[model samples]
Target chain A: MLSCREVTLLLSESLEHPLKLRERMALKIHLAMCDGCHSFEKQMFSLRGVAKQYVNGLADELIKCEDELPPPPL
Target chain B: MKINLEKSTKTTSEFLHDGEVVEDLRRQMLKFATQQLGDFHLAEDAVQDALIGALKNVTSFGGRAALKTWVFAILKNKIADVLRSKQKTVNVSSLQGAGEEDENEDFMSLFDQKGGWNHDDRPSQWCDPEASLSQKDFWIVFEACLDHLPPKQARIFMMREFIELETDEICEAADITINLLFVTLYRARMRLRECMDMNWYQRSQNHAELS
Candidate 1:
């Protein structure tokens, strides 16, 4: 019975922490019936997926640089 | 002194000899530091200091976290230190601009009075979102989109997802309450999704049609 707005609000929180059993059930049921919330959920997933890959690649490039890391301090 | 020497020797022989990899680690740490500190010079200093700290306590690193994560943890502290030192004179208005009120407005704007998605603002399916990851220009556009986020939101989002910090740790590092952290992350994701839709996915679909 959760509204689409409420379901989307919980989306990021669900990624961060587990939703309570009732909240989880409500969200599942809402998403099943709500195309807007479903598309919203899929986009959120894809955004995180693409961002992680791109940022990790940047991190890897940083790690693969040719300049030497500074030596440890005395 | 003897133990210190022994630790240094072991750390060097085990991980330091790979000069290129170590350098890359430094660069990666530097990039993370820069994103946190928002200053090239300060980021360099923070990363250098973090490297020194990491090396000094190399033996203490039990490998519970990845090497990159360990170094970034040190860098986070270093960046926090720098921010603290600058806290007295640093401008606060820009950082505090949107506040909770704006976040409520953002939430409200997403839905109709009856709580459904506003028809005009509902999410659209991107064509082959996974395939966009392979395109060369995708990252360029993505980084630009990230840079477009509000400073605080971008920092918190990157800390949570890219740096992979725990929720409590992110709240502590950003000195924000848990509620504020969640709101900022929610907005960041929403904005990033919108940006990618218009700038990357939508454009690519049009390009495919023309070809």
Candidate 2:
């Protein structure tokens, strides 16, 4: 049984990738019994989505500017 | 002998033409450096220095790495040199004053009141991912929040998260051990989260209520 603190750390990493099968099963079971952890997962998911969107937009702006830049001095 | 001399001159001219190549590389490097350094002046200076050094030693570029990668490596060194020089000039006491008192107190109080990670009861309704991203206000707050991070952590986080570099490359470029890299990234994310939640999201919510 992972405590909320342990689960919180794992939640962030897991959102970045899939957890192992056992870890996934454990998290699912815990979420079934724990509303707090469930809500925490939802918040983490939303936060990750927001961060990715914001950062991706910034990356696009940089890429666009890089494309428009003139060739370097000889 | 004249023909040989002419051939040698042509080679030299080609090398000078490579200077143009170096400039293109610098522009690409500047994009990364500006995002990493968060200071346009520093990024510009670093890019300039890297270009001069690359031109002076153009023959050394043996095509091992892509030209962009090699230029980025040089800019990374320039950034490190600037940080080292700045570090030496700072007084220890002044360093302590940097983000130490008021911000830490505010953050601690907020954590205590909110009951740490366990009590994150803020609603799941987030800024519209597509809409907020296109707004200039979002960029303003985003850049401000990023600039507020401690320098080393900010560099690593920006490289890893914003530039989408590999973890191994970030560790190598930043010259940090894996554990230190992870710790820095965690701290960066936590601070950004706190700042965004406090500065941007709450104010937007307040404006919404009033309107």
**DockQ for all candidate structures vs. native:** 0.26, 0.12
Error of 1 at B82 (Å): 9.0
What overall lDDT goes with each candidate model?
0.65, 0.53
Error of 1 at B165 (Å): 1.7
- What are the interface RMSDs of all the models? 10.1, 9.7
User: lDDT per residue, candidate 2, B1-211, as tens digits?
Assistant: 3455332233322443675755565676777567666567778888889877766766633342334445555666776555445444312232332232223422333233333433553323334433323345554565677778776566666665644565665555555565555556556665666565566555644322211
How many steric overlaps does candidate 2 have?
Answer: 0
Instruction: List the candidates' TM-scores in order.
Output: 0.65, 0.49
Residue A38, candidate 1: Cα error in Å is 1.4
How big is the positional error of residue B209 in model 1, measured in Å on the Cα after superposition? 18
Q: In terms of lDDT, which candidate is strongest?
A: 1
Query: Native-contact fraction for each model?
Result: 0.45, 0.02
- The digit string of per-residue lDDT tens for model 1 on B110-193 reads 789888999877877656444424444556566778888877788778767765677786665556778887778888888887
| Candidate 1 lDDT tens digits, A1-74 | 78787887799888788889999999899888888888888877777766555443323321111121111110
Query: Which clashing pairs does model 1 show?
Result: A63-B24, A63-B25
